[model samples]
Target chain A: MTAAELLSLTATISLVILGIAMLIAIIRVVIGPTLSDRILALDLLTVIAMGFVAAIAIRTGLMLYLDIAISLALLGFLATVALARYMLSRIKDEDDQP
Target chain B: MTALLATVLGCILLLLGSCFALLGAVGVLRLPDLYTRMHAASKAGAVGGGMILVAVALVSFDASIALRAVIGAAFLLLTTPVSAHLLARVSHRGGYHTQTTMFIDELAAASPSKGTLEQ
Candidate 1:
Protein backbone atom coordinates (compact mmCIF):
# COMPACT_ATOMS: atom_id res chain seq x y z
CA MET A 1 0.00 0.00 0.00
CA THR A 2 1.09 3.59 -0.56
CA ALA A 3 2.31 5.69 2.34
CA ALA A 4 -0.64 8.06 2.10
CA GLU A 5 -3.05 5.17 2.24
CA LEU A 6 -1.30 3.75 5.28
CA LEU A 7 -1.35 7.10 7.05
CA SER A 8 -5.03 7.48 6.26
CA LEU A 9 -5.79 4.05 7.65
CA THR A 10 -3.85 4.80 10.80
CA ALA A 11 -5.66 8.07 11.26
CA THR A 12 -9.00 6.30 10.91
CA ILE A 13 -8.07 3.69 13.50
CA SER A 14 -6.75 6.29 15.91
CA LEU A 15 -9.91 8.32 15.56
CA VAL A 16 -11.98 5.30 16.46
CA ILE A 17 -9.87 4.64 19.52
CA LEU A 18 -10.12 8.27 20.59
CA GLY A 19 -13.89 8.16 20.13
CA ILE A 20 -14.12 5.22 22.50
CA ALA A 21 -11.96 7.01 25.04
CA MET A 22 -14.21 10.04 24.87
CA LEU A 23 -17.19 7.79 25.47
CA ILE A 24 -15.62 6.45 28.63
CA ALA A 25 -14.93 9.98 29.81
CA ILE A 26 -18.52 10.93 29.13
CA ILE A 27 -19.75 8.05 31.22
CA ARG A 28 -17.64 9.25 34.12
CA VAL A 29 -19.01 12.74 33.76
CA VAL A 30 -22.53 11.39 33.86
CA ILE A 31 -22.14 9.10 36.85
CA GLY A 32 -19.55 10.88 38.95
CA PRO A 33 -20.70 11.19 42.56
CA THR A 34 -18.70 14.30 43.36
CA LEU A 35 -18.41 17.67 41.62
CA SER A 36 -14.64 17.28 41.39
CA ASP A 37 -15.03 13.92 39.68
CA ARG A 38 -17.38 15.35 37.11
CA ILE A 39 -15.04 18.25 36.43
CA LEU A 40 -12.12 15.91 35.98
CA ALA A 41 -14.05 13.82 33.50
CA LEU A 42 -15.13 16.87 31.60
CA ASP A 43 -11.56 18.06 31.35
CA LEU A 44 -10.51 14.70 29.94
CA LEU A 45 -13.33 14.70 27.49
CA THR A 46 -12.13 18.01 26.07
CA VAL A 47 -8.61 16.72 25.61
CA ILE A 48 -9.89 13.64 23.83
CA ALA A 49 -11.98 15.85 21.61
CA MET A 50 -8.88 17.80 20.70
CA GLY A 51 -7.19 14.58 19.69
CA PHE A 52 -10.18 13.67 17.58
CA VAL A 53 -9.97 16.98 15.77
CA ALA A 54 -6.32 16.40 14.98
CA ALA A 55 -7.07 12.96 13.62
CA ILE A 56 -9.76 14.37 11.43
CA ALA A 57 -7.44 17.03 10.12
CA ILE A 58 -4.90 14.42 9.19
CA ARG A 59 -7.45 12.26 7.40
CA THR A 60 -9.09 15.09 5.49
CA GLY A 61 -6.01 17.27 4.89
CA LEU A 62 -7.62 20.35 6.33
CA MET A 63 -5.99 22.65 8.86
CA LEU A 64 -9.21 24.26 10.06
CA TYR A 65 -9.81 21.53 12.60
CA LEU A 66 -6.81 22.76 14.53
CA ASP A 67 -8.71 25.94 15.22
CA ILE A 68 -11.53 23.91 16.68
CA ALA A 69 -9.09 22.03 18.90
CA ILE A 70 -7.70 25.26 20.27
CA SER A 71 -11.16 26.56 21.08
CA LEU A 72 -12.02 23.33 22.87
CA ALA A 73 -8.88 23.58 24.97
CA LEU A 74 -9.72 27.09 26.06
CA LEU A 75 -13.26 26.09 26.90
CA GLY A 76 -12.09 23.15 28.98
CA PHE A 77 -9.78 25.35 31.00
CA LEU A 78 -12.55 27.83 31.68
CA ALA A 79 -14.94 25.11 32.77
CA THR A 80 -12.45 23.61 35.22
CA VAL A 81 -11.64 26.99 36.74
CA ALA A 82 -15.31 27.88 37.14
CA LEU A 83 -16.07 24.58 38.82
CA ALA A 84 -13.15 25.03 41.19
CA ARG A 85 -14.32 28.48 42.15
CA TYR A 86 -17.83 27.23 42.77
CA MET A 87 -16.58 24.37 44.92
CA LEU A 88 -14.41 26.74 46.92
CA SER A 89 -17.29 29.10 47.67
CA ARG A 90 -19.50 26.22 48.71
CA ILE A 91 -16.86 24.95 51.11
CA LYS A 92 -16.47 28.38 52.71
CA ASP A 93 -20.22 28.53 53.33
CA GLU A 94 -20.23 25.07 54.88
CA ASP A 95 -17.43 26.09 57.20
CA ASP A 96 -19.41 29.12 58.33
CA GLN A 97 -22.53 27.12 59.25
CA PRO A 98 -20.97 25.16 62.09
CA MET B 1 11.97 3.65 2.41
CA THR B 2 11.97 6.53 4.83
CA ALA B 3 8.33 7.31 4.08
CA LEU B 4 7.31 3.72 4.82
CA LEU B 5 9.26 3.70 8.08
CA ALA B 6 7.82 7.05 9.19
CA THR B 7 4.29 5.87 8.50
CA VAL B 8 4.73 2.65 10.47
CA LEU B 9 6.39 4.42 13.38
CA GLY B 10 3.74 7.12 13.42
CA CYS B 11 1.00 4.52 13.55
CA ILE B 12 2.65 2.74 16.45
CA LEU B 13 3.08 5.97 18.38
CA LEU B 14 -0.51 6.89 17.68
CA LEU B 15 -1.66 3.54 18.99
CA LEU B 16 0.39 3.89 22.14
CA GLY B 17 -0.99 7.36 22.71
CA SER B 18 -4.56 6.15 22.38
CA CYS B 19 -3.89 3.42 24.90
CA PHE B 20 -2.56 5.91 27.39
CA ALA B 21 -5.58 8.13 26.91
CA LEU B 22 -7.88 5.15 27.40
CA LEU B 23 -6.05 4.23 30.56
CA GLY B 24 -6.32 7.78 31.81
CA ALA B 25 -10.08 7.70 31.37
CA VAL B 26 -10.23 4.40 33.19
CA GLY B 27 -8.17 5.87 35.98
CA VAL B 28 -10.53 8.77 36.23
CA LEU B 29 -13.38 6.33 36.65
CA ARG B 30 -11.79 3.64 38.81
CA LEU B 31 -9.62 5.62 41.21
CA PRO B 32 -10.98 5.99 44.73
CA ASP B 33 -10.20 9.61 45.53
CA LEU B 34 -10.37 13.00 43.85
CA TYR B 35 -6.66 13.77 44.16
CA THR B 36 -5.54 10.43 42.79
CA ARG B 37 -8.09 10.62 40.01
CA MET B 38 -6.91 14.09 39.11
CA HIS B 39 -3.34 12.87 39.08
CA ALA B 40 -4.29 10.22 36.57
CA ALA B 41 -6.54 12.45 34.54
CA SER B 42 -4.13 15.34 34.29
CA LYS B 43 -0.77 13.63 33.89
CA ALA B 44 -1.82 10.67 31.78
CA GLY B 45 -4.30 12.66 29.81
CA ALA B 46 -1.84 15.44 29.11
CA VAL B 47 0.98 13.17 28.01
CA GLY B 48 -1.26 10.83 26.06
CA GLY B 49 -3.05 13.66 24.38
CA GLY B 50 0.24 15.34 23.53
CA MET B 51 1.64 12.16 22.03
CA ILE B 52 -1.39 11.76 19.82
CA LEU B 53 -0.98 15.33 18.65
CA VAL B 54 2.64 14.63 17.81
CA ALA B 55 1.66 11.55 15.85
CA VAL B 56 -0.86 13.52 13.89
CA ALA B 57 1.73 16.17 13.11
CA LEU B 58 4.12 13.51 11.87
CA VAL B 59 1.57 11.86 9.67
CA SER B 60 0.36 15.10 8.12
CA PHE B 61 3.81 16.63 7.48
CA ASP B 62 2.52 20.16 7.22
CA ALA B 63 4.54 22.67 9.19
CA SER B 64 1.60 24.91 10.06
CA ILE B 65 -0.63 22.05 11.08
CA ALA B 66 2.13 20.46 13.12
CA LEU B 67 2.79 23.75 14.83
CA ARG B 68 -0.85 24.04 15.79
CA ALA B 69 -0.79 20.56 17.29
CA VAL B 70 2.27 21.50 19.28
CA ILE B 71 0.51 24.59 20.51
CA GLY B 72 -2.48 22.54 21.57
CA ALA B 73 -0.23 20.11 23.41
CA ALA B 74 1.57 22.93 25.15
CA PHE B 75 -1.72 24.41 26.25
CA LEU B 76 -2.91 21.10 27.68
CA LEU B 77 0.30 20.53 29.59
CA LEU B 78 0.23 24.03 31.06
CA THR B 79 -3.44 24.04 32.01
CA THR B 80 -4.00 20.55 33.39
CA PRO B 81 -1.64 20.91 36.35
CA VAL B 82 -2.90 24.34 37.33
CA SER B 83 -6.50 23.21 37.19
CA ALA B 84 -5.77 20.09 39.20
CA HIS B 85 -3.97 22.11 41.84
CA LEU B 86 -6.85 24.54 42.07
CA LEU B 87 -9.35 21.74 42.47
CA ALA B 88 -7.29 20.04 45.15
CA ARG B 89 -6.84 23.21 47.13
CA VAL B 90 -10.50 24.09 46.89
CA SER B 91 -11.59 20.60 47.91
CA HIS B 92 -9.24 20.58 50.86
CA ARG B 93 -10.37 23.96 52.10
CA GLY B 94 -13.99 23.03 51.41
CA GLY B 95 -13.59 20.19 53.96
CA TYR B 96 -13.42 17.30 51.55
CA HIS B 97 -11.32 14.54 53.11
CA THR B 98 -9.54 11.73 51.35
CA GLN B 99 -11.46 8.54 51.96
CA THR B 100 -8.43 6.46 52.98
CA THR B 101 -5.91 8.96 54.28
CA MET B 102 -4.30 8.00 57.64
CA PHE B 103 -2.50 11.14 58.78
CA ILE B 104 -3.73 14.29 60.45
CA ASP B 105 -3.29 17.32 58.17
CA GLU B 106 -0.53 19.56 59.60
CA LEU B 107 -1.60 22.59 57.55
CA ALA B 108 -5.01 22.52 59.14
CA ALA B 109 -3.39 22.36 62.56
CA ALA B 110 -1.09 25.28 61.78
CA SER B 111 -3.88 27.67 60.90
CA PRO B 112 -5.23 29.84 63.74
CA SER B 113 -8.85 29.18 64.54
CA LYS B 114 -11.43 31.89 64.09
CA GLY B 115 -12.39 33.13 67.56
CA THR B 116 -15.88 32.36 68.76
CA LEU B 117 -18.18 35.43 68.73
CA GLU B 118 -19.85 36.29 72.05
CA GLN B 119 -23.60 36.05 71.82
Candidate 2:
Protein backbone atom coordinates (compact mmCIF):
# COMPACT_ATOMS: atom_id res chain seq x y z
CA MET A 1 0.00 0.00 0.00
CA THR A 2 3.06 2.25 -0.09
CA ALA A 3 3.41 4.73 -2.93
CA ALA A 4 6.51 3.03 -4.34
CA GLU A 5 4.69 -0.28 -4.33
CA LEU A 6 1.78 1.27 -6.15
CA LEU A 7 4.09 2.75 -8.77
CA SER A 8 5.78 -0.57 -9.45
CA LEU A 9 2.46 -2.39 -9.55
CA THR A 10 1.05 -0.06 -12.14
CA ALA A 11 4.22 -0.23 -14.16
CA THR A 12 4.09 -4.01 -14.21
CA ILE A 13 0.46 -4.02 -15.21
CA SER A 14 1.17 -1.53 -17.99
CA LEU A 15 3.92 -3.70 -19.36
CA VAL A 16 1.64 -6.72 -19.37
CA ILE A 17 -1.12 -4.85 -21.15
CA LEU A 18 1.28 -3.44 -23.73
CA GLY A 19 2.67 -6.89 -24.42
CA ILE A 20 -0.80 -8.26 -25.09
CA ALA A 21 -1.59 -5.32 -27.32
CA MET A 22 1.54 -5.95 -29.33
CA LEU A 23 0.54 -9.57 -29.75
CA ILE A 24 -2.89 -8.69 -31.07
CA ALA A 25 -1.41 -6.22 -33.50
CA ILE A 26 0.92 -8.90 -34.77
CA ILE A 27 -2.02 -11.15 -35.41
CA ARG A 28 -3.61 -8.42 -37.51
CA VAL A 29 -0.41 -7.98 -39.47
CA VAL A 30 -0.25 -11.69 -40.22
CA ILE A 31 -3.84 -12.18 -41.35
CA GLY A 32 -4.90 -8.78 -42.58
CA PRO A 33 -6.79 -9.06 -45.89
CA THR A 34 -5.18 -6.13 -47.66
CA LEU A 35 -1.94 -4.20 -47.84
CA SER A 36 -3.47 -1.19 -46.13
CA ASP A 37 -4.69 -3.38 -43.30
CA ARG A 38 -1.23 -4.80 -42.77
CA ILE A 39 0.35 -1.37 -42.84
CA LEU A 40 -2.20 -0.07 -40.37
CA ALA A 41 -1.45 -2.98 -38.07
CA LEU A 42 2.25 -2.26 -38.29
CA ASP A 43 1.60 1.33 -37.31
CA LEU A 44 -0.34 0.13 -34.28
CA LEU A 45 2.60 -2.04 -33.34
CA THR A 46 4.91 0.96 -33.35
CA VAL A 47 2.56 2.90 -31.12
CA ILE A 48 2.40 -0.01 -28.74
CA ALA A 49 6.14 -0.15 -28.74
CA MET A 50 6.20 3.48 -27.67
CA GLY A 51 3.93 2.64 -24.78
CA PHE A 52 6.32 -0.14 -23.82
CA VAL A 53 9.25 2.21 -23.85
CA ALA A 54 7.39 4.73 -21.71
CA ALA A 55 6.34 2.12 -19.23
CA ILE A 56 9.87 0.87 -18.86
CA ALA A 57 11.18 4.37 -18.33
CA ILE A 58 8.66 4.89 -15.60
CA ARG A 59 9.64 1.66 -13.89
CA THR A 60 13.36 2.20 -14.15
CA GLY A 61 13.28 5.89 -13.30
CA LEU A 62 15.60 6.58 -16.19
CA MET A 63 14.17 9.66 -17.78
CA LEU A 64 16.73 9.49 -20.59
CA TYR A 65 14.74 6.64 -22.13
CA LEU A 66 12.18 9.17 -23.20
CA ASP A 67 14.63 10.24 -25.87
CA ILE A 68 14.27 6.84 -27.47
CA ALA A 69 10.50 7.17 -27.41
CA ILE A 70 10.74 10.52 -29.16
CA SER A 71 13.00 9.16 -31.86
CA LEU A 72 10.74 6.16 -32.33
CA ALA A 73 7.69 8.31 -32.88
CA LEU A 74 9.47 10.19 -35.64
CA LEU A 75 10.77 7.02 -37.23
CA GLY A 76 7.36 5.37 -37.25
CA PHE A 77 5.81 8.34 -38.98
CA LEU A 78 8.46 8.32 -41.68
CA ALA A 79 8.07 4.62 -42.25
CA THR A 80 4.31 4.85 -42.65
CA VAL A 81 4.62 7.71 -45.10
CA ALA A 82 7.15 5.81 -47.16
CA LEU A 83 4.96 2.74 -47.30
CA ALA A 84 1.97 4.76 -48.42
CA ARG A 85 3.97 6.31 -51.24
CA TYR A 86 5.15 2.90 -52.30
CA MET A 87 1.58 1.66 -52.44
CA LEU A 88 0.62 4.63 -54.57
CA SER A 89 3.43 4.04 -57.07
CA ARG A 90 2.61 0.39 -57.40
CA ILE A 91 -0.99 1.16 -58.12
CA LYS A 92 -0.04 3.77 -60.68
CA ASP A 93 2.24 1.32 -62.45
CA GLU A 94 -0.53 -1.22 -62.67
CA ASP A 95 -2.81 1.33 -64.24
CA ASP A 96 -0.22 2.22 -66.88
CA GLN A 97 -0.12 -1.33 -68.26
CA PRO A 98 -1.56 -1.54 -71.79
CA MET B 1 3.82 13.71 1.18
CA THR B 2 4.47 15.41 -2.16
CA ALA B 3 6.42 12.40 -3.38
CA LEU B 4 3.57 10.08 -2.44
CA LEU B 5 1.11 12.23 -4.31
CA ALA B 6 3.26 12.22 -7.40
CA THR B 7 3.63 8.44 -7.27
CA VAL B 8 -0.08 7.94 -6.82
CA LEU B 9 -0.88 10.18 -9.78
CA GLY B 10 1.72 8.45 -11.94
CA CYS B 11 0.31 5.03 -11.18
CA ILE B 12 -3.20 6.03 -12.16
CA LEU B 13 -1.96 7.57 -15.40
CA LEU B 14 0.01 4.45 -16.23
CA LEU B 15 -2.97 2.17 -15.79
CA LEU B 16 -5.33 4.40 -17.75
CA GLY B 17 -2.86 4.79 -20.61
CA SER B 18 -2.19 1.07 -20.93
CA CYS B 19 -5.89 0.20 -20.96
CA PHE B 20 -6.50 2.69 -23.74
CA ALA B 21 -3.68 1.09 -25.71
CA LEU B 22 -5.20 -2.37 -25.23
CA LEU B 23 -8.52 -1.15 -26.51
CA GLY B 24 -6.85 0.24 -29.61
CA ALA B 25 -5.22 -3.10 -30.35
CA VAL B 26 -8.50 -4.94 -29.91
CA GLY B 27 -10.22 -2.54 -32.27
CA VAL B 28 -7.53 -2.99 -34.89
CA LEU B 29 -7.87 -6.73 -34.67
CA ARG B 30 -11.66 -6.94 -34.70
CA LEU B 31 -12.85 -4.18 -37.00
CA PRO B 32 -14.55 -5.42 -40.17
CA ASP B 33 -12.74 -3.30 -42.76
CA LEU B 34 -9.45 -1.55 -43.42
CA TYR B 35 -10.94 1.92 -43.02
CA THR B 36 -12.53 1.17 -39.68
CA ARG B 37 -9.37 -0.50 -38.47
CA MET B 38 -7.36 2.52 -39.53
CA HIS B 39 -9.75 4.75 -37.65
CA ALA B 40 -9.20 2.87 -34.43
CA ALA B 41 -5.48 2.32 -34.86
CA SER B 42 -4.73 5.94 -35.62
CA LYS B 43 -6.88 7.84 -33.14
CA ALA B 44 -6.99 5.53 -30.15
CA GLY B 45 -3.48 4.27 -30.59
CA ALA B 46 -2.06 7.79 -30.77
CA VAL B 47 -3.94 8.90 -27.69
CA GLY B 48 -2.85 5.85 -25.77
CA GLY B 49 0.80 6.27 -26.63
CA GLY B 50 0.66 9.97 -25.85
CA MET B 51 -0.90 9.30 -22.47
CA ILE B 52 1.87 6.93 -21.52
CA LEU B 53 4.44 9.48 -22.56
CA VAL B 54 2.71 12.04 -20.41
CA ALA B 55 2.77 9.58 -17.55
CA VAL B 56 6.51 9.31 -17.99
CA ALA B 57 6.72 13.08 -17.73
CA LEU B 58 4.68 13.10 -14.55
CA VAL B 59 6.64 10.35 -12.82
CA SER B 60 10.05 11.69 -13.68
CA PHE B 61 9.37 15.11 -12.12
CA ASP B 62 12.56 16.40 -13.71
CA ALA B 63 12.05 19.48 -15.76
CA SER B 64 14.23 18.32 -18.64
CA ILE B 65 12.83 14.84 -18.80
CA ALA B 66 9.32 16.17 -18.57
CA LEU B 67 9.98 18.47 -21.51
CA ARG B 68 11.18 15.64 -23.70
CA ALA B 69 8.27 13.45 -22.76
CA VAL B 70 5.74 16.12 -23.61
CA ILE B 71 7.53 16.89 -26.87
CA GLY B 72 7.44 13.23 -27.86
CA ALA B 73 3.79 12.93 -27.04
CA ALA B 74 2.96 16.04 -29.01
CA PHE B 75 4.92 14.78 -31.98
CA LEU B 76 3.12 11.45 -31.80
CA LEU B 77 -0.25 13.17 -31.74
CA LEU B 78 0.71 15.39 -34.66
CA THR B 79 1.97 12.65 -36.92
CA THR B 80 -0.49 9.81 -36.43
CA PRO B 81 -3.40 11.61 -38.05
CA VAL B 82 -1.31 12.76 -40.99
CA SER B 83 -0.02 9.26 -41.60
CA ALA B 84 -3.52 7.80 -41.34
CA HIS B 85 -4.80 10.29 -43.86
CA LEU B 86 -1.98 9.42 -46.23
CA LEU B 87 -2.66 5.73 -45.91
CA ALA B 88 -6.36 6.14 -46.52
CA ARG B 89 -5.87 8.34 -49.57
CA VAL B 90 -3.30 6.01 -51.07
CA SER B 91 -5.48 2.97 -50.51
CA HIS B 92 -8.46 4.63 -52.10
CA ARG B 93 -6.43 5.75 -55.11
CA GLY B 94 -4.98 2.26 -55.35
CA GLY B 95 -8.49 0.93 -56.03
CA TYR B 96 -9.22 -0.29 -52.56
CA HIS B 97 -12.74 1.01 -52.77
CA THR B 98 -14.97 1.24 -49.77
CA GLN B 99 -17.19 -1.73 -49.02
CA THR B 100 -20.68 -1.83 -50.49
CA THR B 101 -22.19 -2.33 -47.07
CA MET B 102 -21.32 1.26 -46.17
CA PHE B 103 -24.14 3.73 -46.75
CA ILE B 104 -21.99 6.72 -47.60
CA ASP B 105 -19.17 7.34 -50.07
CA GLU B 106 -18.13 10.92 -49.63
CA LEU B 107 -15.11 10.79 -51.92
CA ALA B 108 -17.01 9.13 -54.75
CA ALA B 109 -19.94 11.44 -54.41
CA ALA B 110 -17.66 14.45 -54.61
CA SER B 111 -15.64 13.16 -57.54
CA PRO B 112 -16.53 13.90 -61.17
CA SER B 113 -15.74 10.30 -62.18
CA LYS B 114 -18.72 9.09 -60.12
CA GLY B 115 -17.07 6.09 -58.46
CA THR B 116 -13.38 6.87 -58.36
CA LEU B 117 -11.78 10.00 -57.03
CA GLU B 118 -8.88 11.72 -58.79
CA GLN B 119 -5.35 11.34 -57.61
After superposition on all C-alphas, the RMSD of every candidate to the true structure, in Å, is 4.4, 2.9
How does chain B score by TM in each prediction?
0.82, 0.87
How close is candidate 1 at the interface, in terms of C-alpha RMSD after superposing the true interface residues? 5.9
Q: Residue by residue across B3-70, what tens digits does model 1's lDDT show? A: 67766787787778888888898888888877788888988888887887777667666788778777
TM-score between candidate 1 and the true structure: 0.86
Q: Relative to the unseen true structure, what is the C-alpha lDDT of residue A9 in candidate 2, on a scale of 0 to 100?
A: 82
Candidate 2 pairs with clashing backbones: none
| Local accuracy of candidate 1 as per-residue lDDT tens digits, A4-82 | 7877888888888888889989988888777777888998898888778877876787878778877888898898899
- Report how far off residue A68 is in candidate 1 (Å): 1.0
What are the models' TM-scores? 0.86, 0.92
What candidate 2 gets wrong by more than 4 Å, as runs, is B98-100, B112-119
**iRMS (Å) per candidate:** 5.9, 3.8
Please state the error at residue A95 of candidate 2 in Å: 2.4
Quantify all predictions' global Cα lDDT against the true fold.
Answer: 0.78, 0.84
Query: TM-score (chain A) of candidate 1?
Result: 0.91
